[model samples]
Target: MAQGDMRDRPRHAGAGDRQMTALDPRAMRLANAETVLRALYGADALSQAAIATATGLSRRTVELILVDLEAEGWVRVRSTEPHASGRGRPARQYAFRSEVGVVLGIDIAHDRSTVAAADLRGRTLHTAVVPMPGEPERAERLAGTRRAVAEALRAVGVRPGQVGSVSVATPGNVNDKGAVDVELSMHGWTGVRLAEEFAPDFAVPVHVENNAKLAVLAELWEGATPGADHLLWLMLEGQYNGMGIVMDGVPYRGVDGAAGEIFWAKGLGLDALTASPLIGLGRLEPEERRAEATAILERAERGDPAALSEVDSFADVLARGLSALSWVFAPRYVVLGGWLAWALGDLLATRVAARMARNAPPFVAVRRSTLGPDAVVRGAIRAALDRYEWTAARPLAPERRPSPVDGG
Candidate 1:
C-alpha cells in the first residue's frame, strides 16, 4: 500500500494499549463487541455458538454483545429453527440488521447522472438515471442529481432520515475532505463543496471522490478482480480518459488526489498517444455518441475495415499508456472500463494486449470491465459503505462511541 493509504487505515491496538485495555473491563467489552460486529457485518445469519467460535469469545460474552447490538438496532434475530436432532429448544439465528439504514451513491457526469441506494452490505436496492439535455451549470447539474437521488430513495421506500452516508463520484481531483480541488468538465464546478451542498438534504456524512478512482474501488470490491491488491482501471470514455490505480489494496491518491489523472496526456507531449478516436465520438450528443460508438464497435467485430482501423488506433494509444503504467506500478491486472471499452469488448483488450506484449510486464493481465456505464455509481455506493464502516460504524476504541444519528 502507498504510505498515505497505509497511514489512513484503522490501526490495531498495540501491545501496550492491549495491556491497558485488558485491565479496563469496559474497554475489553468494547473491543469484544467490535470484533463480534465485524464478523457479522458481511456474513449470513449466524447462531450465537457460531459467532462465539468465529470470534474466539466465550458463549456468554457473545450473547451479551449480540443483545446489546440488537438493542442498538445493529442486529436482529433472523429465524428460529429446530436442531438437527429435533431435541430441546430451537436455535435462533442472529443477523446484522442491514435494513437499518441505506447509503447513497451519486455519479455525476457531463452527459448524464446516476443515483443509487444500497444497504449496509453494499447491495444496491434502487437506482435512477437522469439524462442532462444540454450543458448544465453546477446548480442545474446538482439539482438534477438531487432529484434522482430522491426518486431512487422513494422507489425503495427509504426516507432521507434513513440514509446513513452519501458518496459522490465526479470528474475532478478530490481532496481528503471530499472537496473538489479541480474540475473542468462542468461549469462552476471547480470549487464546489459537494459534501456541504448535499449535507442539508441527508444530514449525514458525505464522501466525494474522483470518478476514476471510485471506478477502481468498484472493480476491487465487487467486479472482476475481487482480491487483487494491485490493479489499474483505465477509463476510455468520451473526453474522460483517465486512470485509477490501486497498490496493495489501497488507492494511490497523490498528495493532491491527482494520482491517476491520465486524461491530461496532451499536456505531457503525448498527443499521438491520446484517446482521440474515442473523444471524437464524444463530440456528438450523449445518446447519439453511445449509439454511434456501439455501432462502430459492432461493425469492427464484423471485420469492417474503417471501423477496425479506428479501434486499432484507439487501442494503440491505450496500449502505450498501459505499458507505461504497468512498468511503473507493476499492477497484477489492468482493467479497461468506460463506454468505449464496454462497447469494444475483447477486441480492444486483445489489440492492447498484443501491443503491450513486447513493452509491458509479462505477468500483467489486461481485462475488459463488465460493469460498463454503471461502474462509477456502483463505485460510489461501495465508497459510501466503506467510509461509513471505517468512520461511523466501527468505534476506534472504547473512548469513542458510534453515532446514534448516523446509525453507526
Candidate 2:
C-alpha cells in the first residue's frame, strides 16, 4: 500500500475544506449522502455508526440521510449483524440500490469514439463504437458524434430524458472555462465550448475532459492503481499524445490547461516526429493502420530486424516524451494507454521504464493500463454519475420573482 505522504500535500486547503467549499448547503448534504451510499455500495453492508465514522458525519445525520435515500429507492437496509466484540446490540446495516437510472460515457478518440452506459453501481450495461470520418469538417463530425451517442443510449433502452448526465473525453487540454484546446492531435478543436455545444440538446450537465486526464480518473476509480495519489496517465497513440496528473488523489489541471502536452518537448525536438513518418503513416484509416501495425508486431516477434528497429524507434520517441513529463510532474506511477499501446506490449513499457530510470529520478514506476482503450469512456461514465448525484440531490435555484401584476 502506498501511504499518502504528508509532504506532498497540495498548497490548497485539505479535502474537508475543499469538499465543503465546492457544494452549497443542499448540495453538501447530497454529496455527503452520496459518499455514504458509495461506501456502503462498495462494502456491501455497513452499520450506520460505521458509515458515520468512515464519512465523518454524525450517526444521527447518517440515519437521516439513509432514510431519505431509501425513500428515493437509492438505498436499502440489510440484515443486522452482531458485533464481533459483542460489546453492544446487533446493528442495522445499509447498502445502495443497484437499479437507479443510468449514466453515459463518451470517449472521442482520434479515429473512433466509444459510448457506454452504466447503472449507479458502475456496471457497464451497453457499449457502441462509431468510426471517425477521415478529416471531416468539425460541424459534421460533432453532429455525427451526437447522433451516435443518442443511438447507443437508445440501444441500451436508455431514453434521452432518462439519462442523468453525459461525460465526454476528448484528446487535448480542457480548461476550467470549459474550452478545450488541442493543437497537436485534435486539430480544429481549439477553443471549443463543450458545455454550450452539448448541454441544450441533452438538457443535462455535460463534463468534457482531456482523454488522458479521464484515463487517470478511471484508474483511480476502478483500475489497478485504485486510491493512488500522485499518478500520471500517458496516452500513446499516433502523433497525438496526452497526459493526466493526479496529486494526492485529486486531478491537477495546471493554469491555462496545457499541463501535459509534452509532445512539444524542446530538448528532444519531437515536433519532427509528429511530421511525416509517424503522422503520415497514422493518417491511414484506423483499420488499415491497425492491420499494418499488428503485422509489424508479429514480424518483430518473429525476430525481423527491420520491424524491431521500427518498434524501437517508436519506443524511443515515447520514452523521451515520458522523461520530459517525469522531470516536471514527478508522479509516483505512470500509466500507458491508447490504441498503439497494444502494439507496444510489455516490451515497450519495460523499455520506457528503463529509459526513465536511467534519465529521470528513482521515485517513479511505469505501468501499462489494465483498462486499455475503454478507460476514457469508463472515466466519462464516472464523471456523469457524479453529476447525476449532484443534480438529483439539489435542484437549481428558482428564478427571481417579479412584483404582483396589480399591486405596486
Candidate 3:
C-alpha cells in the first residue's frame, strides 16, 4: 500500500500476507475470515462462540481466523471474559476496525455547491454549503468546490491524505472516463477532468457524475424507489434541469453520456401554456422563475382557473414526453425530483398519472423523491464509499453476503 494514500490500495493487505492462489487452502480461510469481519461490522463486537454459530463454523475455526485477522489489523480483540462457571477460559470478543479512513462527496449546482465527509461505513461526519460565483469560469467553480471540501474535511478532523475517495456530482455528461465532457450548468466547464484536478488536491481517486443520474442512483440505493430496478427520474424543477434514466438498478448515461438530455427537446407547445401563467410573478426577478413555477402549480392544485389551466397544460406536455420515454425504456418507477417535486408533490403526481397513465406502461409507478434536494449529494457520497470499497475491501466483498449472527 502506498504511504498516506489509500486511494488505490487495500486497507488491510500488509507485506506479511502470503500470496494465496485460488487453489490454496488459505483462500477459503481468507473467505471465512471475511465472514467473521462482516459479522462484527454490524455490531461493536462478537464473541467467538457467537461468530462460530453465525458463520456455521466451529469455535476453534473462528478462533484461528480471528487470530489471523487480528494479526492483519482488520479485526481487534476487545476482551476475553470468563464464563459465569469461572472454570472455563473467558470468551473471546472481536471487532471490525471502521476508522481506517474517510471519503468526500461534492455536489455542484449552478449557483452553489455542497461538500460532505463520511466514514467508510457511510456515516456522515461533516457537511458544508458554499456559494459559487454566478456564471463563473470552470476554474473558479473548481476553486469554490475545493474550498468547501477542505472546510468539510477540516470540520471532520480529517486531512486530504485520509480521504479514501472523492465523488463529485455535476450537471453534465460524465463519460465512462469520469470526466465532465459536457457541463450545462457550469459555464466554461467542458472537459472538466475530475481526477486531474482533485488528485493533486486530495491524493485520492475522484469520480465526476451527472447530478440527476446520481439522484436516481441515490434513490435506488436507499430512497423512495428502493428495489425499483427500472426507473426514470424526471427532475420536475431544477437550476440544472434534466432527466436521469436507470435500468436494472444502474444509471444509464448513454453512449456519449447524454442519455437523459430530453429536457432540451421542447414539445407539445408547452412554452406558451406553462410560461404565461407566471409571467408577472417574477417581476424582473429572473432568479425567481423556479419558485414562481412552483406557486403556479400550487394554485392549480387549489382549482384556480388560470393556474389550473396553465398547470394542466404543463402536465399535458410532461406526460407526452414521459410517454415517449416510457415507450423506449419502460421504467418500473418514475421519480419526480427537484424543488418543484418537493413543493407540489401529490398534486403534480396525481395530475401526471392521470394524464400519462394510458400512454405509459402499467408497471411504471410515479413517486416524488423522498430525499428532496439532498438526493444527488447522498448518491455522490455512496459513490465515494463505493470507490473506497474498490480499494479497501474489494477482495473481502462483505456486502455480497449476509452476516450469520446479526446485531443491530
CA RMSD, predictions in order: 6.1, 9.0, 7.8
lDDT of 2 by residue, 282-384 (tens): 4333566556667777787798998777767766776776677678777888887765565567856887788888876689898888886678888887777
* Candidate 3, lDDT over the whole model: 0.69
Superposed model 2: Cα runs more than 4 Å off: 1-39, 52-64, 79-92, 183-188, 271-292, 394-408
Model 2 reaches what TM-score against the true structure? 0.78
Q: Choose the strongest candidate by lDDT.
A: 1
lDDT of 2 at 382: 70
Give the top-scoring candidate (TM-score). Answer: 1
- TM-score of every model versus the real structure: 0.84, 0.78, 0.78
lDDT of 3 by residue, 340-408 (tens): 567667766777888777878887777878887788888898778656742234222233211211110
- Number of clashes recorded per candidate: 0, 0, 2
Regions of model 3 farther than 4 Å from truth: 1-20, 23-35, 38-61, 67-99, 264-285, 288-291, 294-298, 390-408
